[model samples]
Target: MPLAQRVHNLPSYLFAGLEAKATELKQRGVDLIDLGIADPDLPPVDIVKQSLIRHLDDPDAHQYPSSVGDLAVRKAVAGWMQARFGVAIDPAMEICITSGSKEGLANLSRAYAEPGTVVAATDPGYPVYANAGAILNGAGFRALPLTPDNQFMPDLTLAEGARLLYLNYPNNPTGAVADESFYREVAAFADAHPETLVIMDAAYCELSFLPPKPPSLLQFSKNVIEFHSLSKMMNVTGYRIGFAAGQPEAIAALVKIKTQLDSGAPVFIQRAMAEALAAYDGVNPPADAQESHNEYGRRKALLEKGLKDVPGVKQVYPSPATFFVWASVDDDVAFVEHAMEKGVILTPGRGFGEAGEGFIRAAVTTSADRIELALQRLRDE
Candidate 1:
């Protein structure tokens, strides 16, 4: 008659009421322009689609895949890392295929965190880093604040002795990115704390609009592990294909836990994702990928310009990465609720952590024309 204690320990879902309100508004014929979630609007590039279609009839697609993933997919991941970041990776020893980066990230804590020790993650970050990681595993959780003064990256030194540390760049919610210099700092931090297994969430690295592109943590740290998502980079979010690569020990630990939990991601999906990863053309993507980045950049610029005239927006955080615009407001909750009433949905920042109390993030994951209309409504209100 009751759920597990861990389920009860989970924090209340912040958007439950928002979803209810949106339903009521839509029922009343209100046209809601949702800018809340970071789901890609575009379909996967042709190569990825054709690959999946071509592989659909393979007899292997119907059978169970290796828990660590098929050799072909792992080799694709290794090649991508080398081409994209000049980072050398051994597919057999260092790569583990994951259903998605979120799964690997949550499982990193499961593999590494002990019950009494803490799992540290950047605050105002993806909730999975805390909820499904530390809390579900009965490990203590720590919020290492990402402040504007630090360019939205917490000092990794603060997480010393932690069982596992989660980091993201071209970050979600904040749109901040890290550079090679910061990664060097990360390397130093890892060296200082050998017990801490640094986990880099590189889901958005390839989607940045800025020049010089984002740097990979692998360039500087052997003590770190990275979970990358083809879903975000290839506009194939539903495919749920990603991989964890880095320190061999970290990869082995995750693969061990994953084996006990379930079989590997669907074979067809893995092969399809391999097509996408193999197509990545170094730091600057090929035609289709660049087009998606450019489109999101335009939408983000339009949203930022519109926010300049909006009533409650105090400041718009400018970072040359991610398809999100983080805006400071007097009160994030009040601002989001007011926008919802006007038929535009956004996520309040405080839902992430206390560090996000005064901000709101806008995901430019819609069409330009629809985004224009949404901004106009906000201006009108």
Candidate 2:
């Protein structure tokens, strides 16, 4: 069978491959602390689960969902935007529910990118952004190197004719975030470009621990479209519930492509997502969830402390948000492989981009005890 050229060019997700290897080792009776994946260890509130189960047997929910999502789900998403970011969005025209933010982001790229079109993206970014660009075939993706010097934000001034610019905060692999001034500058840059379509991937927005709640693309430009996923915040990665909100025209283009893919996410899932979003404002993290965050915070602290004494480890700082720590380690691939051999799986930064080489991304998803154990193993190695 002839696979699409785009599929041929896309590499397997680095973290995914690492997790698979860890699983293989575990099956062979090796004890491993699997920290390569960013999946939250918490479950959504019981309310969300109960809501889904109640609708599970509803014959109506068994049918295909509305293409862009049921009106209720879209309204919930818009309400979420307004409540969380103070950004008013039109539920009917400016929002679309996707199976996952990943789908929305990839489809958005396909919708807007054409041959010879240039896209500006950050290095050490979520690889899907670049993958999405490559799949457009005619589009050229230029990775704007992200480094400690610039505080991990891309310098838009360096990008030219950039039709699509991808920004991820609480950034994957790095866990770095930009400030409001940075966002304002990006907004001004977008205004100057006029033609550029900014695609902001805010999957980690709800997971932030910093102030100002991480600026939304809507806070910057109307030309921006952004994605959110329940996979992270609601601990429903398997549910594939996510949404895109912003720019009416961009949402319309994505919806057009979406209609041709699968019917929207399952109706019951959308209903459950609505319930989750509705309660998000007041829903305190369950005791277990709270404990998990504490544990992760401890793990991050441990990593920060340990790296301080490790030779050749540089730019080690605590990320104000997200469940991962990014540190620059010379020979990151070697570092990752060495950790894996010691039963602690880590994702190599190089897997994200060339600039990512010599860096290692460690996920803080495991239990505190396990994290401590992993740290010990890391130090011993």
Candidate 3:
């Protein structure tokens, strides 16, 4: 049997190795406190559940949904975008409800990238950006390394000639947030290169701890396509619902590709998502919003304080958004292995990219007490 040539080019998945190690440890009876994967421990909001219940009995939900998504769901997304970012989107032309942001992103690459085209991404960033490009046999997958000096922002000079540039603010592993000025700079950069399209991964947009939530790239320029996920916002990772908004042409291209990949997301799930989005006010959300934000804040502080006291551990990038703390250490892989031995699991920065070699990412997805315990174990190690 032979595998696809593209599979040969793909690097080993970062989290799969960590997950396998965790399973091995659990089978051996190790009491492991996993801080590696970013899946929130919180349950989906009540509205999401209630909506699904109401829709599940409808026979319409059992059939294949429109590839572009349910009209009501698309309208709800547009409404949310308008209220949250002050950008008006045409539900029929500018939005595509995806199974999840991850699937949307992968398909976006397929829509735009080709053998002679370049896709630029942050080196110590999401692996999907680079991997998606590779799957298309892209001419070049350029990695703009994020470093301390650049405030973890990818230098645009390196991305010259690239057709797609992937950016994640309130970033995944680093948890770094981008401000208005940075977005304006990116807008100007996009203006200079009209041919390039920016893919802004705003998965963590709703998880900001600071005032003035992260701004949408749509608020800055039309050259950008932004991916939004319900996984982080509504604690609905299992639902696999999200949307891609921006550039009408891009949305159409993605919808065309998705039409062949899978029937749009399940109709019941789409109905549930629609209900959740309609009720959400990003500026003044439901009361439960503060609970998760405050809890993550407390967990982040606890982990940061503990890491500060430990020898050889440095809090290199303290984030104002997201539930992740990126720290610098002597050797990320060794630290990850040692932490696993001590019954604590963390993600190595090197797993993100070469630029992440000296760092480690700890996710605040568990309760504060468990985070404290994980911190204590790491410190004692």
Candidate 4:
């Protein structure tokens, strides 16, 4: 039977052949050192795990959750926003609990993008922004190039008049970050174009290794809807707990669209996320959150050091935040193939977007010993 047209419209899977190759290698008795995907190797901190377990027995936790999320959970998220960014958010009017930022991102265009409306995003950005935000909805897309000259930040002017603008910071693939001045520029642009709505995907905001955590775009402009995820921060990816906060109109519209979709994120998971979010010590999170950064830092350092002398690697892009290290290669596709042959798995940059063509992204999700081993294999040590 033929599938829906939308299924066919999806972009090619980034790891299409890599999975099969992995299986073949495994069957042939090759042990692979994977630095492929950027999933956290750490566990959710004690606070989150305890919270989840503490609430598991409550009968209310087992019931159908509020489609827009429970009021208590929303209030917790609002409180976190206030504590972390000093930004006031109305739990009722501005915040909507989501299964994950993925759900909100997928539904954002559905709620706001009328057919043929333009959706703008950074090139070499997360694919969801292009697939869910534009293609599936039949909205026109404009790619704002993120070349090194621009420090991987899209010029706000390039996104002018777009119906919806998607921004990710401590960005995926490249790991570039935006500071206050850029956000101020974004705010000014938003003020000028009241018709365009900016969506900030702040999934990696708290994972920075440098001092002074990344600032929220909300602190600069009320014109943005920010998606916060507990996946990377709290190591709760499987829980799928995230929230969206912004203008009431946008939140309401998203909630309306969500009503027809999944029921809601589980009440217990929401409760657990709420408790964990409260553990933040104002702008800076405590030890639990910092643990991932430190460990990933070690692994990333190994990759940086090992790849430094590799003949094929042109430049190892400095990633101040996220767990992935992006490096320009002579031939991205060939680099990944060569790494696989050396028993190390990596993701080719072209998988992210056209602009990522000559690069490869290596994740630090594995243990330090494994990372070292991968490096040694690459170096023929």
RMSD after CA superposition, every candidate: 1.2, 2.4, 1.4, 1.4
Please write out the lDDT profile of model 3 over residues 266-342, one tens digit for every residue. Answer: 99999888888778656655567567777777888777777776556766578788988888999898888888989
Clashing pairs in 2: 99-240, 115-138
Candidates' C-alpha lDDT: 0.87, 0.79, 0.85, 0.86
**What is the RMSD of candidate 3?**
1.4
Model 4 earns a TM-score of 0.97
Task: Please write out the lDDT profile of model 4 over residues 1-381, one tens digit for every residue.
Answer: 998777788887868898889889989999998888777878778788999999999888998888899999999999999999899999999999999889988897799776769999988888898889988887888888887888888988889889999999889988887878888888788778888999999998888888667888888888788999998888778889899998788899899999988788999999999988888888766586677678877777778878776768888878678888888888898889889999999989888788889998888888988988888888773
Which is the winner by TM-score between candidate 1 and candidate 2? Answer: 1
Quick one: best lDDT, which candidate?
1
lDDT (0-100) at residue 152 of candidate 3?
89
lDDT of 2 by residue, 1-381 (tens): 998777777776666766677778888999988777788676565766888999898788888777689998899878877777778899999999999998888887777787778877889888877777754455777988988888788888766577788888868878888788877887788778777887788898766754546768796777778898888776778899899988899889888988997689999999888877877553344444445555566677776676565544676757877888888887987788778888888888899998898888888777767877887777773
Candidates 1 and 4 compared: the better one by lDDT is: 1
Count of clashes, each model: 0, 2, 0, 0
Full candidate order by lDDT, most accurate first: 1, 4, 3, 2
lDDT score for residue 148 of model 2 = 82
Report the candidate with higher TM-score, 1 versus 3: 1
